[model samples]
Target: MAHPQPRTETSSDAALIRAWQAGDEQAAAELVARHARPLARFLAGAGAPDADVDDLVQETFIRAFRGVDRFRGHCQFRTWLLTIGGNVLKDFGRRAARRKVMPLDESVRDVTGDPHEHAEASEVEALLAAGLKQLPRLQREVFLLRAQQGLEYAEIAAALATTPGAARVHYHHAVRRLKEIVE
Candidate 1:
């Protein structure tokens, strides 16, 4: 018996979008699988709570699917998805502000270690989360996109609707501030 050949990943997001629009449910799944974890990490690093990350991710995908027809290939799909995730974060922040609730803690992970190491890591994570909260909105977005999501300045700028230079500045300032706090 002959073995079936494995499918290759699509070279471009436009192809995936076309597949999705053509009613291939697997295409949507592929897109989500490609982008979801990074988006969740971006949200968590931007001060969203661990409990709310999954809901926010679901909402992001729903919004993306609803508006996929509007997506032109001007930017990469990751950039576009980050833009959607940013908007969701902003909306949540606005609502939280209106309700007079504190924004969620930005730290969600506890890296495994010995007891002393665990304690030290926890303290550092808490401090880092506090420092992240102190950053301006744009700085936080830029920093998280670059640091957590590993997006380049161009991608960060596209996601945040800013110039690459501006994104670089925001990221620099964020790194400086975080270093001051962490070190």
Candidate 2:
């Protein structure tokens, strides 16, 4: 007989959102704890400055909770939260652009240990960052959602307000563009 699989916190994000909607404060905390890391990763991959990632995550959660009542469950809660994060990041970018103070060199974190490996990793990261920056907003968001967040095209479409077919096309275009840029 096969053993039953254990349930993970990831699978319960929707349940946590429901609990929070019902006025469960602990559930809100749990959702934040469960999603914070992934959201941070997504934000960083989308080119949020290292110094602003924590603030961006906080802002994303703030907006999500404030608009929680509007969440209609069309997508996963994490996807919805990330959609809010993308908007937050876009607004932040626009503000930074207006100030003519955009920063792109802050995404590479210092890695300890072997010097050669670190150099190679940093080079790849830089190339990817440059490539991502060149993509159109929809392609960038779709690529990050599908590639980095491991979301399905359907989930990405729901989050980005596009059709699944369009999401797939955007992701493919992003991949093709990145490959050309890298090569």
Candidate 3:
């Protein structure tokens, strides 16, 4: 490999991956450090609870590093990482679904403060959460990727393994439903 360029926030992920492949551990750390925030945001927006987002982010990177050989240059690295994260959360949801539901006060409550106790923005956020939960999984994921993460439809399509046209349709449906619910 050519002289490794200085690692910075702006360094291309492909370059970081190449250095990592060449045995530079720091390159891997830089990759995680650079993208972890965005990955966490995506996870949170995709319906991961506050308590679980950190673990999900770590697992996403672990899977990515272990499966690096399989990563084709089909999408941006962050997009790929988000895809891994969505899978992790899906698996977690599946396991949780198998367990019996517990009453909110008995089984568990969100560690984040009371969902009901809040001002205007908080109320709006709560409403949005309820609306999001009602969306079909694909529509919810598409909406979050496009609206919250600011990804283009092509990137969202790549991450979600759908066509760009389908992704666009999902986004429109999600927006219509959320508007009906939130407003």
Per lDDT, the best of the predicted structures is 2
Q: After the best TM-score superposition of candidate 2, give how far the Cα of residue 75 lies from its true spot, in angstroms.
A: 0.7
lDDT of 3 by residue, 1-183 (tens): 666478778778998998898899999999998999998988877777777788889999999998998888888998888888888988877776788542132114433555446344556776787788789988988888888889999988987778999999999999999999999
Candidate 2 lDDT, tens digit per residue, 86-142?
999999999988999857484346557787887877788878978998999889999
lDDT of every predicted structure (CA atoms): 0.81, 0.87, 0.83
Which candidate's TM-score is highest? 2
lDDT for model 2 comes to 0.87
lDDT of 1 by residue, 50-86 (tens): 8789999989988998899988766788778877888
For model 1, the run of ten residues with the poorest summed lDDT = 103-112
lDDT of 2 at 148: 92
User: Model 2, poorest ten-residue lDDT window?
Assistant: 2-11
Model 2 regions more than 4 Å off: 1-11, 107-110
Clashes of 2: 0
- CA lDDT for candidate 3: 0.83
Better candidate number, 1 or 2, judged by TM-score? 2
